[model samples]
Target: MKLHTIDTGFFKLDGGAMFGVVPKAIWNKTNPADDKNLCTWAMRCLLIEDGKRLILIDTGIGNKQDEKFFSHYYLHGNATMDSSLAAKGFHRDDITDVFLTHLHFDHVGGAVIRDGEKLLPAFKNATYWSNRQHWEWAVNPNDREKASFLKDNILPIQQSGRLKFVSAQDGVSFTDDIKIKFAYGHTDAMMLPLINYKGKQVLYMADLLPSAGHVPLPYVMAYDMFPMKTLDERKIYWNEAVEQQYILYMEHDPVNECCTLQQTEKGIRIKDLFKLEEM
Candidate 1:
């Protein structure tokens, strides 16, 4: 199996929201914010080529939103989904599965595209993957999360009759070498892919662990539906990651593509940082 890092580019998010209760004075040292108090982050996605199936995890924020909407989050950078795929000698049509970690606009936005007056699935040949629980939660979103679950980025997959659900069971096998691990703190039933690659296990840290800077136990995000749940999940995952020596694939880390954790004097901290290709 071969894995490629698909970078859709970078976007800015409020530093406060990304770091939750962590004070700006602290998080600022690691992720400096711009004059607007927004920190730049990468919309990094992962592509797995296993046998006949080419699976993509997370579609990044797409380009269908209006100017006013996009003005909120400044999307920048030259790398696009198509360009990144082409660099790997592939195209959107070559994708066999799109495994969305969640239905948030930034994560699943590129799953659909605007075609005339209708919104349609971008990858015409790929089967979109989501879970039943997350599907229901996103479709009937709460007031707090409704803004992130845009209808334009979501409904089209189901409407196109290409959406499929993985079993909600934790540790369910998505493929012979890939397993799904569910986290409820970020949103309901957010699935993180655990794949066996090149004699090592790679864990796709969706929003569970957005960056290596968030390795501290208290560095939970304010956007999480349940911050305490996230703290608990992080403790479990961080310990397991250290014990199992898993390479964490960061989704929003602007600089680092991947990292490993080591038990530190304070807590689980970043041991080493490198790119996915370095594996």
Candidate 2:
């Protein structure tokens, strides 16, 4: 099996929201913000190539949103989903499965595209994978998360008859080597893919741990529905990651792509940082 990092480019988000209760003084040291306190973050996606099945995790924010809408989050950078795929000698049609970690606009926006008067699945020949719980939650979103769950990005998959729901069972195998781990704190039933690559494990840190800056225990995101639940989940996963020696594949980290954890006196902290290709 081969894993590739598909960078869909970078966007700016409020550093305070991304870092949660952590003081700007501390978080700024790692993810320094701009004059407006907005920090640039990568909408990094992953491509899993195992034989004929090419699975893509997360789509990043697509280009379908209006200019006014995009004005809010400044999307910059030259890399895009199409360009990144072409670099790997592949195309959108090459993808067999799109495993969404959640239905947030930034994560799943590229799943669909505006085709004139109609919104359509971006990957014409691929099956879009989402869980039943998350599907329901996103369609009928609460006030806080409503802005993130755009109908144009989601409904098209179901409407196109290419959407499939993964079983709600934790640790369920999405494939022979990829196991799905569910975390509820970030959103309802956010799926994290635990992939076995080259005899080692790589955990896709989708919002559960957005970046290397979030390694410390108290660095939960304000966007999380249940911050305390996120804290508990992070603690459990950090300890297990250190014990098992898992390489974390970060989705939002701009500079770092991958990291390893080490148990320290205070708690588990990043042992080393490197790109996925370095693996």
| Model 2 steric clash pairs | none
Whole-structure CA lDDT of model 2: 0.95
lDDT of 2 by residue, 14-64 (tens): 999999999999999999999999999999999999888999999999999
TM-score per model over all chains? 0.99, 0.99
What lDDT is reached at residue 145 by model 2? 91
The whole-model lDDT of each prediction reads 0.96, 0.95
- Residue pairs in steric clash, candidate 1? none
lDDT (Cα) of model 1: 0.96
Residue range 1-279, candidate 1, lDDT tens digits: 999999999999999999999999999999999999999999999999999999999999989889999899999999999999999999999999999999999999999999889899999999999999999999999999999999899988999999999999999999999999999999999999999999999999999999878989999999999999999999999999999999999999999999999997888899999999999
